[model samples]
Target: MSAPFDLARQRFLTRCTVVSLPKPSPGAPPPSVVYYMHRDCRVQDNWAMVRASQLAREHSVPLKVFYPLFPSFGNMSSRQYSFQLAGLAAVEAELRELRVAFHLDHSSPPAAAVPAFAAAHGAIAVVTDHLPLRLLRSTNAAVAAELDALPGPVPLIQVDAANVVPVWEASGKREVGARTLRPKIGKLYGRFLTQFPPVPKMPAGSPLPPPTDWSAARAALKVAQVPDAPGLTAGTAAGMAHFRGFCETRLKKYAAVRNDPNEDAQSGMSPWVRFGQVGFQRLALDARKLGKHGEGVAAFIEEGVVRRELSDNFCFYNEEYDNLKGAAGWARESLELHNKDKREYTYTLAQFEKGETHDDLWNAAQLQLVGEGRMHGFMRMYWAKKILEWTESAEQALEWGLLLNDKYAMDGSCPNGYVGVAWSVMGTHDMGWKERDVFGKIRFMNYAGCKRKFQIEPFVSRYPPAAENCRKAGGEVALAPGVKAGKKKQKKA
Candidate 1:
């Protein structure tokens, strides 16, 4: 007989995508279950882990957690890996408390490591978290094929622990925008947002795996750490602390000052949420339980659940998420129409990387990313638009923006970042704004426009631009109304 809590969890597995392979022949040994952990890194409040445990108990077999380390896993930087491994350390300990075995290997690729390990270890089923990114999606397919080619059969299950409303469940096809996706999520999240059952106690007296040497694991990473995000720590505890701090200080003012780059009023949960240290559902539930935040709570949900899931929906259904190819036909047409238009100034990727752009505000945004491994959310759109303005083509702009974003933002190389860059450069979910040179019908934002929204001078002063390193080019050739690139007035082309 299974515990009632485990029963509830087992029922929840119905929400996951499960594929059952051919069952083993008669007189075969009972196979253990393995969860090939990837995206989500938490133990408590983790759906996939709970489902894996339930399946293992159903078969009266052992359950294990397996993590594969590849530096090139997602083009992650040292800072990204540092935050991930730190949170993972907490997961290992928490799982030990639950008596679930945790296994991590510095294997070349998960496609080979995961299936090979399951086959050699006599596993019955392999469970994993859902990921929509191109590389991860392809890797998952490869792993599934590898496992299927083995002896009898190995069932593969994928759980979407990332979103409160699973990406697929939210929508069948790519969503048009938040408005299209919001209604469905609003109707569905409540069902999936039930209280998470506590981690089940594994079989008593089961021999535990050896402790993971987190230090050695960090040292072995192929990615190199740059500067860490100041004052931010990794793990579930840290994530909780940050959430509480938001509720106390910023939640009430979130809608008001969230767009102001000068104020630190955002939730700041992306780093932890990106690494799965804190579940989006968990955050939503806790924030509501606190009964605080006044009106801003709805604003947070709109961004965290609706917009976040919309990013996943875009990535999962659309293959060209990282570039202009994924843009709406209107956007693509608009950019093509303006492609030949002359830009007043252009900057090489290296120059942009050095924060040597002609605009001090743009330079400051870049400096924050390079210096602190994080950037203000509002400035992200402005940063990418400036790249589009200075670059020769939309393709180059997307490439350059992704390069910096994935390299610097603690939560980059993700669906959100990919969709964000696409939103800014390619206009993925956004509709065309006023037509202009370089940007065409896509939205146009300039220094003067940004200054009107926030305290641009304070932000610029906070992170001084590398002026000595700057080599301003294409000066005085172009001028328009409103936009400012130094003393020259930004004018219409």
Candidate 2:
């Protein structure tokens, strides 16, 4: 294997994995180095982008960004696509300013599409962001294989742009819990949690093409019909603005009330982080400066860096990340023991998806996710556990929970979502609690439990019954929070 690239801050090279190295060529030099923008979409504070640009400059080649847009990925809808496309539009504009050509490939199995794009562009090397999920890992492997087969054997390099300390570097095996992973991350934070060097202006080698037609891009997706999230805006600028607002406002209360569903205390940057519109490292760096909110900053770092990275570790090392098989031996054994325990209430996937359940709080949480494209972090635990309580088996609960989360939440289809649902339903990354009928040793959540934490009734009131149900009764359905029901217009003369 070739030695790591001679980029500044040799420590940063630890964040990269050289999957394959290019063969020395005896022909004309390639024209560009291709950076396949996938998980990390932003043009700034992106290590993969930075590394790719540096590689391009080293070889005296232009940098080209190849983005493969799948027609449908991760059970996404128009809501997710709209947000993603909007972000990519901004990425294209930013790349234009840097004189880096942006190419969008409407392709599948990015492994094939990416290498082909690189070869077509005469790329000497391919660099892409790393993700720890099964699909992403497998795709990366396949891409590496294809790149190795090319005439020049173009190098395929991966940068862990999403996590502060790279996943593989943090731990070689799956961590038991945040407790196990936290110390490891804490040790490395000093070395990894530093400021990012700006992606400098590229050497002018090639003229850029006209900007991407985002409308046509959206038209190409065969996604679900979910509407855009009402209030949340997409793109790095909006995401950065939101993070600043969180630090200025909600962050002070984050440590105290982040778990209370009634308070807006959590940093609402999950969607941005999920979409890679902004780097979590940037957020962590800025948050650390707020020494005034010492407790809050500590809590944010724990959750954002420690817990988030833990999720990546879980998904990275475990192949069955989305299912019961991914659970620990203790969790799986306990779940199996309780698999046939009679559930007081069992709901089908349809009922779960439509938020038609007996529990008002559960239904409200479901409605919140369906309508708002997000559920509070605290409620998500409850929301998923109830699926276990009401589902036929732990396997079904895992399946349904993942499906619903990925379909509705903008941050769905990520390592965090997989681990969150797994933690809730199968007790992954958690110790077994007192044995219960359906829950076995898996931790149980209930309506009374939610009441103890927050004002369930008011939270329920914020999200009334499902809209379709109310409409079926010929009644005016209450809208989501911040969207007032406008007065009906009088009949025209």
Candidate 3:
């Protein structure tokens, strides 16, 4: 077995499991290496792209970057599509400068998209980043099979570029909680967290096919266009700008005011990170250099590094991660015992989507997701918990909550999103709390409990409740009687 450091580096080569598919045809002439850029979208500090460039350089062959555009995947909306399409423009330009080809495949089903193109181009190998979601995994398996049968055997490689510490390296099983996973990651992160050597610029080769028609790609997806999300922009440069500003201005106050919804102390990098516009390794290296502390820096690393990877671990290992079955056996049993418990109110999925709940605070959280494509990180817990309270059953609430969240949240549809909803409703990684009417042993979050932490009413006014639950002249929210909420949470899954 290789030493941990060497193995860690090899693990980082693609993003998830470093797969060398098609079994490498020996004695076969080297063909172009193609990189199917998926979840991670940035050009700099990207391991998958970096490794692909290296392989292409070693083989003395051309490198092709492909972005397969499925008309739509799952419940992702137009707003999400708009951000993804816009972010690729920068990725295209950067790859061109590096002498790599960038192609956006818009042909109906993405499963056939890349393999068909690679076969036509007589590609020898394909490299792409990782994602732990089941749907994406199925799509990848289908694509790999196609590549293997292509006129020639074509190899496909996958790298874990999204996580600072690859999920498998972090833990082999779904961790019980952040505490259990934190030390494991802390022990090894130092070795894997070193600087990412840049992808050395390649000589200007033949130009790539005409730049992908982003406008047409946008039209093809046909998703709803939510207002441009505040502070969250689409692209590597924008992501860096937002992250740099967060480290400079808000890093110090993050630990104190992060849970307060009205504060801007959050990193606001979800949309960027979700789309791979920014690399987590880049953020960590810079954070260390800044030397910020006081729970702010420590907590940020815990969430961004350990906790974030735990979410992927959950999805990668637990096939039932998105539903109640994914919860702990204790949690599932407790919820089942109370599935028919009477509730103060019950709302349908449509009602939940329209933010028509009786709770003003809940409605405000929903509106924030609807109008801006994001909800304050702390409020996400409150939002999901409320769904469980107001809906008919835990199963219904879980499904509706996932549906609403995946449809609106900019960071929705990844392992983080699935694990978050599971954690919120199913208590996947949490200890059993005091039993309650509906929640049973599940960790319950309510409006009063949130008030004990920070004033949540001002957040309601800021987003404006639905017509049924009108907001009065509620002014600024205060953390205490005289103090106002001063910081926002650093980041979310």
- What lDDT does model 3 reach? 0.77
Worst 10 residues of 1 by lDDT: 7-16
Candidate-wise lDDT, in order = 0.79, 0.82, 0.77
TM-score of 3: 0.89
Q: Write the per-residue lDDT of candidate 3 for residues 160-255, one digit (tens) a residue.
A: 888887877888887898888888888888778877767767766655788788777777775555555555568999889988888889988898
Across residues 187-244, which tens digit of lDDT does each residue of candidate 1 receive? Answer: 8876777777665778875567899877777777777457676777999999999898
lDDT of 2 at 458: 69
Tens-digit lDDT string for candidate 2 (1-493): 2123323221221222342335546674446889988899999888898788888888777889999887887677888888998899889988888889998877455778997888887887788888777677777778877777776667777788888888878887989998899889888887787777678788776878677777777888887798888998899999999998998999899999999998999988999999999999889888887678999999998998999999999988988998888889988998899899988678889988988766666777899999999999999999999899889998999889988998899899998999999999989899989998988898988766675677765687777674444344333433344666588722210
- Model 2 deviation from native, Cα RMSD in Å: 7.1
Candidate 3 residues lying further than 4 Å off, grouped into runs, are 1-30, 222-231, 466-493
Better of 1 and 3 by lDDT: 1
Q: How many clashes show up in model 1?
A: 5
Off by over 4 Å in 1: 1-30, 466-493
Ranking by lDDT: 2, 1, 3
Worst 10 residues of 3 by lDDT: 470-479
